[model samples]
Target: MKDNRYSLTGYHKETNEELWLWDDLPELDMEIGYKVGALLHYEQSPFQEISMIETKAFGRMLVLDGTPQVTAKDGFIYNEMITHVAMATHPKPTKVAMIGGGDCGPAREALKYKDVQQIDVVEIDPRVIEVCRTWMTQETDYDRDGRIHTVIKDGYKWIQEQKNQYDVLLVDRSDPYGPAISLYKRPFYQYVYDSLTDDGIAVFQSGSPYYNSDILKKTIGSVKKLFPIVHTYLCSIPSFPGGIWSFTIASKKWDPLKADLNGLQWQEAKYITPEVFRASFILPGYIRSKLEEK
Candidate 1:
């Protein structure tokens, strides 16, 4: 994608959207031709358009039909906070599993912790793995960590097959649709519960606070049914459909806000700061009422 980084060249036809393609595009390793125009991205079944688009800028970006979907850049803030906070608080986090992060962003972010020795990245699409390498960049340290071992398989299958438990389970998935539809199921949450060490924490990307409130609440409720502790947090990432997004953190033993970072200091990031980190946990009045939480 990067090698063939094509800007919106020219939109064609007068259908629902303005269809366009990259001129200097990479080999369409997985497409007959993409139907992308204006804001809509779809392809015929034999040439099915995308339900997703993974980019470093927007994080795990998705554009389905004619609407813009979630972006990973803003989503990463909550993800990193949820994941690293839990791991840092642990006495030691030697092993971790990230399900459905085909973009490999979370795996790249998790490697920042020196204590993390093994990170298993399970993505459902191998094609995604291929595209991301060209799209995400070879220069970023997030993608260049040594601890990551990529597994091209269904995350559920991979999680089920493993007997060895993990210190943390990060469900870095797209919104609960397409291949990700299975990820939101309660049975999957129970499997996640079984797959974790006694001290394990499971964190997932819930949808936006401003949009899809019902979906976020239902998903949170499901995780709450599966774990003793469940909490939702928020962040603002501009590229997503909604301006601010949410995440749910579920745990059996550790709570994120209370977790110590174990002196694993990181440099400043554009989104997640100490102040923003603390502030993100403080849900607004509207969102709190949405959860029916005081």
Candidate 2:
């Protein structure tokens, strides 16, 4: 392994347990460390380094390029919030397009809706899906459901080819870096705007409000220029850096705040309820002030 700060190294010496340390927010001089009970799998894929490790705290975790992507314990919070908010907001989301959710967490939640007929998952790296399927057995079995069509291609290019097709578009990508950098920019967002139906709604996982305010602002700002209705929401995920994560929902016709989520039913969803949906959009003063910045 490379001798970088992000590398998964040996024992911590103090506790004598293997440690997987990630310097995700190096600019802030903050790092998150996990006690690794076992290293399940580690390899270099065509796009990035992938690792599956069992941690004492978070159970099985999927790490990508040294950053923790998802953990078995609290991943439901993220998956449920990202999927259900937009799903319930739109009246009938029949066709869906998901970009960068190779772990199938968002896919799993989206599939729970009976109105959803098909989902096109465009993932840049095939290895991410392969590795997650092998180790993250708790995730959705994509093979069992014919509604999911997996396309191993760059999300930026794949989205450009689509137009007025999907009823809902889910951008479940990582932070703006590496292969995902383009996904956060304006050109890619324009493609996302174009790919949606007239009444379509799109949801993106904007990063932490406390740490990634600039990113959240930029993402919402860009999408606001394209869509008539844009609103930002919040969810708490224990695995994330700031504990509080933001998601932006942009719609062509419907207002998410006025969404009649009373009829929507998903027994499998753990974090999101109709009441939770209403409260998620109620952003704090600090976050409102950040978005208001010039």
Candidate 3:
């Protein structure tokens, strides 16, 4: 029953039609596969290997370093959860800075608020943006929106040069690996702290609690040391390893639980609603135990 035409990394060297792509999670000794209709694009950028594949289930998918980053169908779940939770929690977020959201999902969600004046998207790999623009136009075609300023630079380096600048800081980068490893450390969290306004808020995609508990623990633990208030929230993203994913929100003053949605204009959002936002922070008993673990 083994399929010789599909490799763990990519389509087999022998054939191209009806291929399978697997995201290998070595930590858990598991891998997830998608039935690909076609390998739309593939290339080795200066930073990493980027690919766009047409999947039978998810429509189109953006893969980085042989892992699926986002898909055309359920990508809104991650993007909306990450962006809206913090944006809604804050009183009035005008200036925002997003690190490593090259696919522009978080940026697109952030743009829905009329109060947001500017958004700076710092991505290390230009090809991520390029590939997303070309193949995933529905998600990445917001470049024409004047409020967004795409900065092709390293996020860790870029944030270090700023001070008291952004009202909201969104760390939407990849998992802790390669160039992004630094972004999940204490020093980078300090930089995030410094880059935010007095009452600013910051949020990070901390990965799945079931599989990536250490990452969630580290993100919450690290940010807790710096910010007066920190909370871990969960959302469901069908394309991710575990359908359930975690996000950490850190604040200088505002309480995310006390988010005011009466005046906010976000009717366009498909995933996040008032009830869902309130319920997202209500972690399960095991997750609470996971956060409490040493």
At residue 115, candidate 1 shows an lDDT of: 83
Task: Order candidates by lDDT, high to low.
Answer: 3, 2, 1
Error of 1 at 190 (Å): 0.3
Tens digit of per-residue lDDT, candidate 3, span 144-258: 7899999999999999998999999999978898888999888999999999999999999898899879999989889999999999999988888779999999999999888
Task: In candidate 2, list every pair of residues with a backbone clash.
Answer: none
- Cα RMSDs of all predictions? 8.0, 2.5, 2.2
Candidate 3: regions farther than 4 A off: 1-8, 13-17, 139-141
Error of 3 at 79 (Å): 0.7
Model 1, stretches more than 4 Å misplaced? 1-82, 139-144, 262-264
Return the TM-score for each candidate structure.
Answer: 0.75, 0.93, 0.94
Residues 1-294 of candidate 2 have per-residue lDDT tens digits of 213333343323224333555434677877677766777898888888888889877889998877889988998898888888888888888999899889888888888888889999889889988898998845445678999999999999999899999999999989888889998988988999899999999999889999879999999889989999999999999888879999999999989889888645556678888888899999899889988989
In candidate 1, residue 232 scores what lDDT?
A: 83
Write the residue-wise lDDT of candidate 1 on 201-263 in tens digits.
878878878767877888788888878877787877665554688878788877767755444
